[model samples]
Target: MRNQLPSSLHNGMMNYLSDLEWKQVLDSLQQGLCCCGANKYADWLHTPWIHVDFLRENSHTVLRYMRVDGRALPPVLPSSCCNPFSPTPCLHDPLQQQRSLSVWRDTPQTAIDTVFDKGCLDLILQPMVELLTAIPIVNGCCIALQLISGILLRYIYTSARNSVLVGDPGGKAYGWIFGRGDCRFALGSSLLDIDKKRAAKQKPSGNSGQESKEIGPRRHE
Candidate 1:
């Protein structure tokens, strides 16, 4: 499926990340967020799967930290982990501790920090923006293709109608050309309308662009 994409699309996907920018993104992921709340950790862990899938579908390499029981481990021990609310501390068997220690020692701190700090949230945003931006472009392409198909169908029907008018004594020379053409036009027009509505929905409001521009220069200072 990836190989079938046009080179321009491939380049567009590539433009979303460079080696350096990607490293920064990865670095950001490695930084651990202070474990303040379970809800925060949950949001950090689960919300980015949607973004990761989006990037993977778009041919971007997605980096993820290892998981245990489907949950991502934090870089440093969170307060919750360090001092549990429960009266008794969760006990790991000696074998479990040995294995955990070995794994912890082997893992790179940077990678752990990236995963623990950011989870997949930052990584997810870049692909999400690209995905949002592509919607209008895709809608336009669909509209264009449908319009072309309708035009061709109309032309073919017109030619057949003309031939029937010239040669056939019976008015029925073109059996159902007009009906078929009308159906094609109706289908095409309906689809175009739907796409136009979608494109409108996908478009960013003027205020958003203005806000971005307004914020851009201040960031450098």
Candidate 2:
């Protein structure tokens, strides 16, 4: 991500004059980060955005003209590239070769000191590196937690099985932890034994009722 930042920033900056959102983004980065350009202020020299005109001379038609002398002006930096501490006017005439203290200049290091000389990429890269570094550590922690949970569930299943087979009370203790689900799950056979006893008692009562009916009919005859 860091290696590709300069070119990406450059392309984004190339749209600075034509796209309002791009202009705002670059302005925010320049002002908030207190840095200039992709690598240095000199990067703006090759950008086509400098020559693009915002004003259309007439309402119905679009028109473009060179500076007063019919010669193209030199590359100009945006007002956002000005240092907050500089008292001088931030705007710089593109045709002039002299550097202004208020604005970011070409060969920024040798200029009168006011504007930020560092690249915006350098200011932002460290935090991005730290964030990327933390992602794998978080994923590893999640995997470790999942493994531990799997081991714990297997242990519970084993304990519950043992209590059912060996008739140990420990499974009831496990049931307390799971709101009695473990007891119902482990003691399912005891419930089935109860149902069988109830069926047998009902069968004997039905046989007695049939015997009484046969005795009554013989007495009547």
Candidate 3:
């Protein structure tokens, strides 16, 4: 459960992992990837992946590759881009796509990216080069861009849901990494404004016995 995360994680991370969440994270990570050969390993588990590293252009990006080896694969990038580290991450991207892992496994699996897919970038080289030249105009912009990009990806694919915790064990106040969460980022500015207004209104010299009237919901008849 989400509320139980702190104590449960504190108790131990693997300890409280539920069947659904476990299956989801594992499914998401190894979704498009399958193993073959003597020793089996999860597919694309390694990051700074070849397509990300070797692709010359967007079109040539490994995500666009038709096959990993001789076998076809799925377009399994996160739907929105946000730090997956962010719990309750928000933001959305329309580009995110989902793929059935079962389909890819029926065919053989492929792991050789640098060796086989090297020439793919040539197709988009010119425009990509032109775009790279313009990068100097933006400095350290990639960090913010990736953060937003990752957040935008959140909407594209189905992710494992955090457990719905009613309360923390023994009723202690639960710890949360809420500072980086979407709810904070989205409403923090407005909340700060409300805090300031409340502080000002509590002053001894402030207006008294004033009540605000409630407005009916827009949809209410």
Candidate 4:
């Protein structure tokens, strides 16, 4: 993705004036990212937008383009690349833009003072790298959370069973505690097992009660 930005941006810049949507997208990207051309602001010189034929159609005619230090000046940069805080008047005046371009060629190190010199590729890749770095951390946190939850549920289920076995006051309360709507929803079949255990305990007592009633009726006879 980082290596492909130059060619993609070159194509986008070349087609910028031809398509209004592309023009807007390129403009917004440059302005929002605070970046210039593909690899550097100088890269814009190679795009079709800088050619005389294209410029002539847009009323930016140049009878004879200027040169500085025996080097032809790159045409004015897109307004998007111009630094709003810079004292340079390169963006609004064609001559000043050419002058700044010449200055840049003479001293590449000072380019950012006049226009955004950093490549869009580096700025775009920084955030992507940060997000990828965090993915493992986020995944580890989720796995730890699941482990803690499983341990907690196992502890609660065991404690509830022990309370019922020791005949805690209101032993049926153990059933009610796990049988509530939210608990059943979360524990599902675990609560069903508790219900089955309670039912089994009650059955023997019911049978004993029936046997005693029969014996009493026989003695009366």
List model 4 lDDT by residue over 1-221, tens digit each.
Answer: 76676677788887776778878987888889988887777677655464444444333434345233222334457778877778754342244456554554576445556678776777878899999999999999999999888877866776666566556634543433334344346545454566577779867765788888877755434
What is the C-alpha local distance difference test score of each model?
A: 0.40, 0.62, 0.32, 0.65
Pairing residues by index, what is the TM-score of model 1?
Answer: 0.27
List the candidate numbers ranked by lDDT, top first. 4, 2, 1, 3
Best by lDDT: 4
In model 3, the runs with Cα more than 4 Å from the true position are: 1-22, 25-64, 68-70, 78-81, 84-221
Error of 2 at 29 (Å): 1.8
Task: Tell me how far the alpha carbon of residue 86 in candidate 2 is from the true structure, in angstroms, after superposition.
Answer: 4.8
lDDT of 3 by residue, 67-185 (tens): 54522233332221123333432222112312323323452232121011212123224466667787865645877897777765553221211111322233322222332234546
The sequence of per-residue lDDT tens digits that candidate 2 reaches over residues 146-174 is 98888788667655664565455454312
Deviation in Å, model 4, residue 210 alpha carbon: 46
Model 2 pairs in collision? none
Reference-based TM-score of each model: 0.27, 0.54, 0.14, 0.58
Q: Give the TM-score of candidate 3.
A: 0.14
Clashing residue pairs in candidate 4 (N, C-alpha, C atoms within 3 angstroms) = none
Which pairs in model 1 have colliding backbones? 29-114, 30-113, 30-114, 31-114, 31-117, 32-117, 33-117
* Candidate 1 structure quality by residue, lDDT tens digits, 14-113: 3323444533433343333323222233332232222222333322112233344443222233222222333433221112333444444475332233
TM-score winner: 4
Provide the global lDDT of candidate 1 against the true structure.
0.40
